[model samples]
Target: MQEYADPVIDWLDGGRGYFAKKLYRESCALQPNGSYTKDLSLVEEDLSRVCFMDNSPVSYNWNKANALPIEGWTSDPNDEALLDALPILDSLRFTSDVRKVLGIRGF
Candidate 1:
């Protein structure tokens, strides 16, 4: 998963390192017993400060209030999903708790 995500993340940000952390199936988010279920609390102690984006709802099962669900990216030239989300992402950075905005927006 890390190998697959690295290129996609690079392409999205042009290797500028926009993402502070990258967690995958093999990351600390995984259960200590080696289960696949993710509990993001392991990766970030403060759920209020995190906004996890995933195409799969199951991925954010443990933290639905803090999720920012996005459609899976295809190579669609007309795709503007990310573009549409920029304003929210940008504004949330200035807020005290991201979950407050996410919840209010019904994300």
Candidate 2:
């Protein structure tokens, strides 16, 4: 689970970084342990992060459009080759958001 959780954290942080830099569509990735049977709290936290709303450095989220230039690792770590891992993240993020907004409650 940590393997998945760690990557999710990195992706969230990266997406938040991009969003902060005003790179909207560029910021997206998948969450680990995301499913109909997963923990609701974790899922909510993950969604909030992708939406650029989470504030914790451990999490990640949107903040001020057009942030300053970054120094490293903007490229997708999951695949510096294909960049196809991002949409999975985006979909998971959106799913969590929809579930929360719709008051779907727990798994």
Candidate 3:
């Protein structure tokens, strides 16, 4: 569980960080154990350090166009490679977001 903490925190602090917030709410619903509860709080703090909305003009234009930037998007290849090595993180983030939306409407 401790070994899972850092990856979870990083995923929560990534592009789809909002999924972490939704996961936290769901975990709280499950009545998790002490260690899991502690991890959640720590991840929450990490999430706080992440900026969800990009206020830049480029970001605004991209949002309006419903497209993502292809160039100069990633600054760290090593970090990108590291994330690529952990494939489950992407699934986890997506699943959490879907779960959150479904949970909201009692689906």
Pairs clashing within candidate 3:
none
TM-score of each: 0.74, 0.24, 0.19
Q: Which TM-score value belongs to model 3?
A: 0.19
Question: By descending lDDT, how would the candidates be arranged?
Answer: 1, 2, 3
Q: Order of candidates by TM-score, top first?
A: 1, 2, 3
Judged by TM-score, which candidate is best?
1
Candidate 3 lDDT: 0.33
At residue 97, give the lDDT of candidate 3: 38
Off by over 4 Å in 3: 1-38, 45-84, 97-107
Largest lDDT belongs to which candidate?
A: 1
Off by over 4 Å in 1: 1-4, 7-18, 28-36
Write candidate 1's Cα lDDT for 18-77 as tens digits. Answer: 666778886535556544555777666887778877777777877898888888777798
- What lDDT is obtained when candidate 1 is compared to the true structure? 0.75
lDDT of 2 by residue, 41-65 (tens): 3333443443322222222323222
